[model samples]
Target: MTNGARDENVTLEALCRGDVRTCARLLTRIERGEEAVIPLLQALYRAGGNGRVIGVTGPPGAGKSSLISCLIGAWRRRGLRVAVLAIDPSSPFTGGAVLGDRLRMVEHGCDDGVFIRSMASRGQLGGLARAAGDALTVLEAMPWDVILVETVGVGQNETDIMRHAAVVVLLQTPLGGDEVQAVKAGIIEIGDVYVVNKSDHPAADRTCRQLREMIARGSRLRPDRDWQPPVIKTQAHLGVGVAELVDAIDGCFAHQNADPEAARRYMSDRARHRIGEILRDRLDRRLRSGDEGWLEGSIEPVVSREKDPYTVVAEMLSRL
Candidate 1:
């Protein structure tokens, strides 16, 4: 093997053996979408499927960072190594994270058992970075017990996290109107655990009541009569109700472990989604490399009504 390939294999081995620096470097390479990242990820993918991945998502101002901070503490107290991937909004000019969640979680910087990385959403509408799944694979190779993913706080389109995480925590506050509408729209269906954060507010009880009712109504529509999500109230900043939230998450994990079919289905879905993402990325790269000119030429005819977009796309695919 070549020197570079040998070096990569060494680094991959170190990463799997719990080398923190190597793990961080591999994650950074994945986030940058480096060409060499694919081989590294493939080598490490099978070593994963052991870590518990938890996704936390909510609208803006839901205090997700604080909640995650509390979770880290709780998990650490139980002697489990944890990794966090916090997806933040990208800066339009630089395509970097605008506000890194690491700042909120500074207290854990010195903790040896914790590893945290912040990723930019990079304009992905799903509230996750494009490389998030790949990053998770890398983290899973390391000796982590749990991996927490905190999304960019986009109100809608955050359901993409469901494809990667086994357990999803959807946070909502007592903001009343728009918040309730958001829950009704679709986010309520994806959660394994519903949390009414900032529960110290006067409307906390009402928010919990509304969420329970919606979950009850939604459960009836689901074909599978399993796993009724429990809504718990929490004042995250004050560290209240966090233990119960952890227990609920742990219970959900236990339930999934007890059902082998459900576990297999979740893993199968994640694999399918990962394959689709890889195919799409490859196609995009191929199109950018040599097909841009042809695409531009084709666009004008469609714009002038000479052809429809579907036909043009078909012709392009046939050429491929």
Candidate 2:
């Protein structure tokens, strides 16, 4: 083995032995795009199917963190080791997260049964998705029995989590407006289970009903599925209805894997995504450095509006 491989093996061995420091280091390396981590991922992937990956997505302040905390409690009761990849949106200007999603789960930070890592969007929507996968890979190398991905409640681009997770739980609040917005965002189709959180709120039932109606509409349009997504109500903080939510999550995983086509779509999306990410990184580097002659030439005219962006892009590609 090369020196890097030897070092990686040591790291992997430490991970398997439940060394949090080694695991954290490996995760950092993976985040930095260090190839030395590949062997570690390969080893973990080879050991395959070590954990159940659950994705929790919804609108902001929908109590997703509380629900996740409840779920972690549930899993912990079963004596399962859990890992959470909680993604927060980076500021458009500063690139730092506005709120620390991981901080909300600080109650479980010392559990030893749980590992929670806070991640920023990093300006790549796809990066959040891939980082979740990488985090899962590293956690899988350890003794984790379940992995949870908590995405920033921003609906757009967050669907990328569906590719990596075995089950997706869509959370929402009592606002009729948010339910309509969720439908418009196409989150309805991607959800395996729809959770109407904050059930103690007065509008919870109405929001639940609205989601059901939306599902009914989708059901009529897409009649091919044997199973339909179910809406469950919960007050996660009080732990009311958490059992049913867990059952729904289990059922969704069971149903999702039973369909080969669903698995195929996920695999295809993941494979294509990896390639696309590499190209995007390369292109971004090229553009930032002004290394490509075409981009260098097109910059001034496009900025000056002497040439439109569309024409400039076309000419640049043609030149390349």
Candidate 3:
């Protein structure tokens, strides 16, 4: 095995061969918030993207894990390698996650074609672990044909999936009009494919109808304006309709790639978002870096009303 610390090309080569041990170790280091992975990530970025990043997000008990497991099976049957990152809610005190999502995927444990890893959300907002993009950078460099990212089952505005994935699948269970109304507009705007899971439920069709109506009227803010988001129903646990779900996903990806204009626009938007994310994360670390004298110098004036916050912000921005 090549030493990733010394040779990023060698590491990239190993990763391209789907070196599971190396990938796992790198992800572990990244999840611990290590700074050492930066160069490797840079190399991977320059190496260019490989896998299709598919993001799955929905509310709690939406059977996202089960659906993902089934999707992995479907993709594997198509002779495609699959990787999954399941983001579990972390304990606030311990900064640890139970990783129960992994349990739901035990069926795929023996498959060499599939790799499943659970990441702690670590109190990060936007339904993902703070290290998600870093983790994704690692996976996207690997040999996987598809990389599946499952969120921590958060609410509407937290649809950070759009920033990372080329395709986003939003899941929902059967619901009445009122319950469907609770699915906020922000989430509605983010999904490239909407799914009504648990299709066996009595109100499933009604829920799908409501979703279509909402999707039809919401003025979808998607860059692929010529594309129409499809709504599919799946009984995931029974493995029913999963093939259709996969078909929809395949169709969505094809549609997004079909138009040269949409493809460029989407890529540009995603790059812009990634830049903003990196800037914010870097600035946040700098601010919270705990230089007592520098902090006291910055805060004292504001405390004494000698400096307005906006002016102080300008000063800090200039310094940073």
Tell me the TM-score of each prediction against the true structure: 0.94, 0.84, 0.90
Q: Which candidate is the best by TM-score?
A: 1
Candidates in order have lDDT scores of 0.85, 0.76, 0.85
Could you give candidate 1's per-residue lDDT for residues 209-249 as a string of tens digits?
A: 88888888888887563888999898887899999999999
For residues 217-291, write the lDDT of model 3, one tens digit per residue: 764544338667788999988999898989999998898788888888878988998889888988977866775
RMSD of each: 1.8, 3.3, 2.8
Residue 247 in candidate 3, Cα distance off native in Å = 0.7
Better of 2 and 3 by TM-score: 3
The global Cα lDDT (0 to 1) of model 2 is: 0.76
lDDT of 1: 0.85
Sort by TM-score, top down from the best? 1, 3, 2
The residue-level lDDT of candidate 1 at 146 comes to: 93
